[model samples]
Target: MLIEVEVCDVCRRLGVPVTSYTITETESGRSVVTVRCGEHAAPFEEVLGQPVEAVAAAETPKPRQAKKAATGRQPRGQRAERQVMTREQIDAAKAAGKA
Candidate 1:
């Protein structure tokens, strides 16, 4: 038979098993681990001095709108074509005062 052991340092005082925990390291190469039950897990945010839920929500990306695909159909307006004019036709129109 195998037996489970609860060695959470934080919950040892309360005699509770650790279900959640947060481990942090300081600048001096010292590491600190805090183990707590589900109810006490929220208090870990006090170490960072901010609401952990708000931070997590803010960092999550919102869903984006789906992009529309091209239908391959031309637009409703008529396509315009360019007319090439020659110098002689221009001069004739100007001489006839039709320009």
Candidate 2:
């Protein structure tokens, strides 16, 4: 005999299809089943007050550093308000190769 399983309650409420699921028994001996796609399972675990297990312990990639300007000068508007430099002064320093 073929058994038909219902789509995940959370995903169905959110208008999505069921692809993954978890069955849990409450303290009161009531068995509750939750169905969700892989993407929604984490949130479902939070709703069910269960700890979500990591599928794979992949290392997170390090964040990339911002590239420096070709002229070796700090970008404008990023400086502190007390250390403002005028365009003319900056141009003079660049021309004198002191920037």
Candidate 3:
């Protein structure tokens, strides 16, 4: 998540804490940017000129991680590849004393 925020100059001068602000450009050249709290926005705008809405840069979203499987065994399809003997093979092996 991305957020744009600034401190109030008036509050700073008054030794008071402030949070959240509206951003603006005060000059035609876009050289001066004014960020102030809501309480002082109108007053600051009266002096610096009406706020020229500033464009915020787009933030790229992060990629999500893939969840790992919790089971301690492989999928049925994968296990099917293993070789297994039938009952007859087992019996023959037992008779041959190789079981």
Identify the candidate with maximal lDDT.
Answer: 1
Residue-wise C-alpha lDDT for candidate 3, range 7-97, written one tens digit per residue = 5665644344454444556665454444456576765445445334421212335689976655987754465366699999999999999
Alpha-carbon shift of residue 40 in model 2 (angstroms): 6.7
Let me know the TM-score candidate 1 reaches against the reference structure: 0.30
For model 3, name the residue pairs that clash.
Answer: none
**Weakest 10 consecutive residues of candidate 1 by summed lDDT:** 7-16
Model 1 lDDT on a 0 to 1 scale:
0.65
lDDT of 2 by residue, 37-84 (tens): 656686555555643343222234568998776586668657645767
As for lDDT, the candidate ahead, 1 or 3, is 1
Q: After superposition, how far is residue 88 of candidate 1 from its true place, in Å?
A: 99
Candidate 1: list runs displaced more than 4 Å.
7-17, 45-99
Q: Is candidate 1 or candidate 3 better by TM-score?
A: 1
The backbone clash count of each candidate, in order, is 0, 0, 0
As for TM-score, the candidate ahead, 2 or 3, is 2
CA deviation > 4 Å runs, candidate 3: 1-5, 13-30, 44-99
Model 1 over residues 1-99: C-alpha lDDT tens digits? 997666555455455656545465656676656666655665564545667797777679999997554477545554547667799998998999988
TM-score of each: 0.30, 0.27, 0.22
Q: Which pairs of residues collide in candidate 2?
A: none
Score each candidate by Cα lDDT: 0.65, 0.62, 0.57
